[model samples]
Target: MARILALDYGVKRTGIAVTDEMQIIASGLATVATKELLIYLEGYFKSENVELVLIGEPRQMDNTASESEVYIQEFLKKFSEKFPQMQMKRVDERFTSKMAFQSMIDSGMSKKKRKDKALVDEISATIILQSYLYK
Candidate 1:
């Protein structure tokens, strides 16, 4: 089976995660600059067989779209245009960042290490993928 990838989109950076070839075991792949995200994915797709991509959908507590969704929507349009054949889906991403932070604490990560925003993004992407898999 082809791998399924996930992204936790941020303004400055984005987190990436992917499942194994068997479509199991979601794992953190990278934290990349948001401005360079498309180029990075293009390179990655050349080496990987990703069948579907899950883009985190930022939403508020009331289920309304988040303010940052305008940015995400713009990225989505660009992505769809760049890779028209590739499939993409948006999975709700509410609280994933907070969850990722708590996860760092649970895993006994150092305070200094937990302060790394990139690490948090990567972990958030992993959590988003894992949540989708379980659901």
Candidate 2:
């Protein structure tokens, strides 16, 4: 079975996560600059047997689309064009960042470490993957 990759797409950095072939236990993969994502993904797809891509969707508190949806929609369109054969899905990402921060605190990470945006992105990606798996 092929693995599943998840993305927590941000304006600057894009968080990445992946699950095993069985699609369990999502783990943080890396955080890359948004501008470099496509190039990086091309290499990744060439190397790994990834079957699906899950992008974090920013939704409103009332379960409606947010302003970020516009950006995400465009990104997904381009992403689909670039990886036409790859399957893509969207997962709601309402509080993944907040949850990532709280998880860092619970894990006893130092304030300096917790402040690393990359770490937050990594956790966010993991959250997205986990959500996808449960769904």
Candidate 3:
């Protein structure tokens, strides 16, 4: 089976994660600059057989769209233009950043490491992919 890839997109950075070939386990792939995300993905896709790409959909407590939703939507448009052949979908990502931070705490990560915003984003992507696999 082909692997599944997920992204936790941000304005400054974007986190990436991918499932195993069997699609059983999700793991952090990398974090890249938001502006370079498509370029990075172009390279990764050349070497990997990704079945579908999952993008985190950030929403608010009231299920309303987040302030950054417009940016995400714009990115999505560019993503479609660049990878029209690639399958893609969106998964709810409410509280994923908080969840990722708590996960770092649970894992006993060093305070300094936990403070790494890029790492948090990567873990958030992993969580999104894992949640997709779970359901």
Candidate 4:
């Protein structure tokens, strides 16, 4: 099976994760600036045989869409237009950031390291991907 990709999209930075071609392991890939995402994705897709995309859906505790929904919808439109053959799934991302931070802290990461939003975002994306995979 081809690999699946997951994205934790943010206004400043976007986190990326990818599954193994066998669809078993999900690993953090990279964090890209929001403005550069489409261009970056174009290159990434050229090199990787991604069969699906899982986009993190930031939701409130009440299961309502967050303020970023507009931006995500715009991205979804572009994503669908570009990768019409690939399927896209939305996975709730409630508390994923907190979980990522906790994981980093539990790993004994330094304060400086913990301040790296890109790394945190990448890890969060991995968590989101893993959640989708096991569902």
Ranking by lDDT: 1, 3, 4, 2
| TM-score versus the correct structure, for each prediction | 0.99, 0.96, 0.98, 0.97
Deviation of model 3 at 90, angstroms:
0.5
Encode model 4's per-residue lDDT on 87-119: one tens digit a residue.
899999888899999999999999999999999
The parts of candidate 2 lying over 4 Å away from their true place are none
Top lDDT prediction, candidate number? 1
**lDDT over C-alpha atoms for residue 49 of model 1:** 98
For all candidates in order, the CA lDDT equals 0.97, 0.92, 0.96, 0.93
Candidate 3 vs. true structure, TM-score? 0.98
Encode model 1's per-residue lDDT on 30-134: one tens digit a residue: 999999999999999999999999999999999999999999999999999999999999999999999999999999999999999999999999999999999
lDDT of 3 by residue, 1-135 (tens): 999999999999999999999999999999999999999999989999998999999998999999999999999999999999999999999889999999999999999999999999999999999999999
In order, how many clashes per candidate?
0, 0, 0, 0
Which should have the higher lDDT, number 3 or number 4? 3
